[model samples]
Target: MKLINLITPSANLAELSSIASEHDLLLLRQDAVYLVHKAALPFPGKVLALESDVTWRNITLPASIRAISDAEWVTLSANASQNLLWS
Candidate 1:
């Protein structure tokens, strides 16, 4: 499965949703952690946000999105078949 990393709040959600499969992992990092406050997320896949970033932004995460540590992020990326960054 693909590890899709979205690093900016302005990243194109339409394009992401179109290209992402249900089995892929969507990782929200950097400014993209702001997306957790949105009413809905576009991608229909497992969603994870950097815990450090979320805490830095003081954003409360919903139950749908998991908070992962940097080590976990590294592990996920290493295990995925492909890693894609969206900025």
Candidate 2:
């Protein structure tokens, strides 16, 4: 699967958000964490939030999305063949 790692809430992601490929996965952290609720991710794809970032912000996200730790981040990176990072 393609791992979409977003570090910023850039307008550039508008086009990428519509990509609903089954092979896509989305991970948000840093400033991009603000898009947890507002940004649209790929359909039928798993969306993960950085647990540390979420906790630090004290923001609650939708129940549908998973919160992953740094260890899990490495695991996810290991599984994906392609990674697209946006800032």
Among these predicted structures, which one has the highest TM-score? 1
Model 2 clashing residue pairs (backbone): none
State how far residue 40 of model 2 sits from its true place (Å).
4.8
Q: Give candidate 2's total backbone clashes.
A: 0
**Per-residue lDDT of model 1, residues 1-87, tens digit only:** 999999999988999999999999999999999999889989988999999999999999999999999999999999999999999
Candidate 2 lDDT by residue in tens digits, 1-63: 888888886646647767647668888888777777775554457778899988988879888
Q: Count of backbone clashes for each model?
A: 0, 0
| Residue 4 C-alpha lDDT in model 2 | 83
Candidate 1: segments with Cα more than 4 A from true spot: none
lDDT of each: 0.94, 0.78
